[model samples]
Target chain A: MTGTAEPIVMDLKRAPNVHAATQAKGEALRAALAAQRTGTGLAAEQLDALPVPHRRVERWKHTPVAGFWSTPEAPSVQTIEAAGSEACPVPGLHAYRMVFVNGTFDAKASDLPVHNGVRCEPISMSDADAGSQGPLESTDWFAALNQAFATEGMKLHVAKGVILDRPLLVHHHTSGENNANFMRHDIHIEANAQVELIHWSTASDSSTGMVNIMTHMSVESGAVVALDKVQDEAGSLQHLAFEQINQAQSSQVRVHTGTIQGNWVRNDLNFRLNGEGCETVLNGFFLPKGKEFVDNHTTVDHRAAHCNSSEQYQGILYGTSSGVFNGKVFVRPHAQQTNAYQQNGNILVTDKATINAKPELEIYADDVKCSHGCTIGQFDEEALFYARSRGIGEKEAKAMLVHAFIGDVLEGFAVAEVRMEVEHRLAIKHGWDTWNDTLESA
Target chain B: MVNIKELQASIGETPILKGLNLEIKPGEVHAIMGPNGSGKSTLASVLAGREDYEVTGGAVDFEGQDLLEMDATERARSGLFLAFQYPVEIPGVSNINFMRAAVNGKREHDGLEPIKGKDFLNLVKEKASLVELDGRLRNRSVNEGFSGGEKKRNEIFQMAMLEPRFAVLDETDSGLDIDALRIVANGVNAMRSPDRSFLVITHYQRLLDYIVPDFVHVLVDGKIVLSGDKDLALKLEEKGYDWIKEDVIA
Candidate 1:
């Protein structure tokens, strides 16, 4: 894997003498992606037209995707039966299901739902898997690699005023070999339409590789959509899921992402509130155990007037794992009365575990109630001692305190089954505390 | 449940408890009244297995087991509870989850299965009303913005929920108002049993009027200087603790 030529590279905006870091990573993504395909049908000039943004791109400095992709990537995804899907249920999801094995969308093992306003289809089905899925915008080398050797991905849309009765569930299950899965999903919720979508991915021990994924969400006027994405795959899987939000006037969108188990999981959720009187809420909970690296970065743009947005993301990191969170609230020069508030709090149980957080506020207009705060701390010692003195052992005591740490975010799930699902994953991720002498000690 | 004989304790290099001895059987309520900086809190801390306080020389036997040898959680599992004078605030964690973990945790420690969800809710509701704590506050962050009286009431609510065999109420009456004081006293009264014991720590004698202590001990500096029946609280109330410090602790 080492001594490999230019691992992965990106093509920045091609400015006059870009920053040295950006230039270096751009070269890396280029080399890493070259092995995917040798100018496969798409001419070299056309591939050059593709967009892959590097560090200098806004909101990407801290995440550092250049180092995320391993030197030698995984084998290709011939096909897969995403196991444990039936046992891990999604009841209200009635839309067409697109199951991915490694990275190819498998329509055989899925049930496609029909509705007047909704359409779910595999993009490669019509193109005979030949046409290139036009360049990934502002994506990194991993995403570019996914586009290079990609097999199949999904495209979903909802018609205006035809609010679907159920959600569309997509299962991205990886298995059998160490492989690279690159996927790009384009989602559109038309005007005055309401929809719920869930992306659940699962993997076992054999599924070891890097997952570079991207999702684009566009909501028209008066549209409402709730998105919940959970990654409970094998702990050895390194993955990335990036999402961008394009919003219109009076559209309400709530996106909640919960990751209780994973290896290296980084997500960038960028929301552009391009209209006035728009309401947006983003809350997430990440409970990572072992040596997992979870980085979550979010940016909410107050592009219009009289708009309100709230952001809260909390997580509990245990063992030797590390987590990073950066939440930015941007109030454009004229976006007055923004009423934006953002807070991120985390608890590190073991001394070796760590969480780095940054909550920033950029307010351009006056008379706005925009405030942000971030905290990375240990559990309350007194509170732990109190619970322990009441017969809870060190681990359960720590879990109890941590359960308290993410209680607010967990309560915001709204759906009983989904809330409990996330909570159950949390319990399992930290379940080691529920075993051993400490379990009996409690 | 607790039986201590001539217990001596020290903080850092200075001694706080010197030859202090007491016996608390089930169903008996004993109050330790002392002025500020006395070993009143120290006694409670040591009983709760707080490691900061040194047991210079003492033997504390609870339920026929070596109380001082057990860790904080072990001592608690063996049926001991302490209501702190100041309950630490744990932000972002709801009261329901914390309470549920605690109840189930304690039950698990007793080698008993976890309490059912419905039954636990009923118990929480019953215990919550016993202290007049609002259900809405249970949904709020744990004491994140609770008032002084609310914290005290919360301590009592916790005590009612755990139902410990021996409880050490460390200054449970300190920041409480008259109404809160009665509610707390009523909660303790409801849990009174021939199989449960209490050690109330307080400064003002007002709390003694509601949950009257069976016996009162006036502590000054680091040692108990005087010990008497419940009337001793009223007498000390009228005469002031400085006099008791002069007569007994001297």
Candidate 2:
């Protein structure tokens, strides 16, 4: 027992072989793109050069995606045609809704009336091609896949000095077995403009589908942009989403991601403070139960002076489920007076559950304040016993504790309807209906 | 009413309450004075059905039912409350919500519906003032960021809301100033009724002065060595537990 331990080595040569089914899917995508004559600025050979995301990569070590490409997938063709459509979950939300069914924007089901200097339109093939220059041309397989096969998306541009009175809801609905879809949304907020945007997606439980999405957002000087994105898909669906944000001088951006329900979900949220005096707040919460796996990866790059960014990502894993949260913050040499804080907290409800949380801060500046911390713990026994001693039974007590654990992150949602909807879903999932009112003041 | 006969218990392999005996009738306040490690807190925890202490031997009857047979939640619903010496801080469970759940839990156990929203709010307002607990504290998380005195006062406020049939004040006066102690004592005194009973465990006679108990028992070495009236507490405080220790040993 006192002897030195041997190091385990993994054979990098044993890479996964490209499946014939995946190659066929790629050929089918190329043919479709060629028939439409849409230029994605990315050559088909470039996408073929990079292998799909797999467990061999350092970032994808915990979550395996090699099987995702090998599975056969077909495009979904369902459409929603009315305001009270069953596809839109948050019904009473008073927002200009853009409903996308099976990756295509349905104008009839949408209530978007371009009134307050805000332009809303579907992303033409050219628009999608223009935004595919950076990572999509490089090592990101998800981004490349989205750019190569994106069937539909939205382009939202808010003019300078305009404040939209209502929020904009972009709803994506998917149905059908073995369905596969890709989408991209580009949001450009001009100087001093303000808007609240909600991106929501749902899928049927019986379908073993996959959806890859990419979003590009730019917040200009003195602008305030708040976004609340929720992904509540089916247990058999696989979701891979990526969002890239850039903030200009003195700009403020608040983003809250709620992975309320999913089976195999991965979210990559990246932020860059390109100008001085910008503030970014990123909050995320995910609950996975019953063998589900969820991963959230976030990066905040501070390239300018006097910029502040804080991230709080948390997860609650139950049953045999597993989760991963990897948050990285970078402070460049010239970015002095940069204050970046990152925290990842997780709770494993059952002994069989697992969580891998890594918070990294790479600081090159000498005069900066950057801190990263991670906590992996279960329910506080004393607190649980305290509640139980007050007659709150075991189940309700556990629900209340979970509510308290994710209370602050839930408060990060900008829209009230979205927050309530997420809370309702959480209550239903955890049998918290009896104690739902306890969350009213939380 | 509560009855305890040779109530023996232990935490792990170490016995804390060895052959301890005590009884309390309706409307009576019994004060147990002892030195540290005399199992004052172990008794309170054992009565509240805390799982940490295992009942090695003995039986406890509360309202004609076996108290040791129920879990903590069942014991709480059966009208037994313990005001923790160091109340745990629940960061997001509001005091108002906690009390409402406790109240409704007991009501449901009695085959009654949950309390109405308006009535619950009124009850919170009335009970919070009993211990001088501010309205803001009631809305905040239970015991989170509360000062020492404020925590004790909040305990009394919860007791007022719960209105248990048998209450155990486990060193409720441990970290209180004179003013806060008087307020806590007054809150407990206000709830004393012919149908209720209390067992106040304290290290000093200072609390018994305000919430004056009917019977005073001296506990040493996990057993009661003397039983007297309120005058015994004054004697014990004046001379300290040294004389009682000598007498018990002899």
> List-wise, what DockQ does each model earn?
0.47, 0.50
Instruction: Provide TM-scores for the models.
Output: 0.85, 0.90
Tens-digit per-residue lDDT, B154-236, candidate 1? 88898888889999999998888899889999999999989999999988889999998888988776666788999999998
B123 Cα displacement, candidate 1 (Å): 4.2
State residue A115's C-alpha deviation in candidate 1, in Å: 1.5
lDDT of 1 at A338: 85
| A1-442: candidate 1 lDDT, tens digit per residue | 1222111122243443345665565556556656654423333443455444445654455455555444545544444533434523455434546677666767677665588978767666644343444444433544445555454567777899878776667778776554567776777789999987777877776666677677878899899988878888873777888787878999998888888778888887888888988899899988877888888977787888888899999877878888889887888777787889898988887899988788867677787898787888777788878767767777877766666566667666635556666666666666644411122112
- Superposing every Cα of model 1 onto the true structure, what RMSD results? 6.1
* Number of the top-ranking candidate, with TM-score as the measure: 2
Candidate 2 lDDT, tens digit per residue, A1-442? 1131111111222354655564566556555555654546454565676555555555667886645443444544657642224645885889988888767777767878467788888775334445543444124666767776664688888999999999999998777666567788888999999999999988776656678888988899999999999988874777889888989999999999998888899998888898999999999999999988899988888888999998998899999999999887878888899999888889988999999888867777889999888999988888888878887787878888888888889988999999989988877877775544752343
CAPRI-style grade of the A/B interface in model 2: medium
Who wins the lDDT comparison?
2
Indicate the residue-level lDDT of B172 in model 1: 91
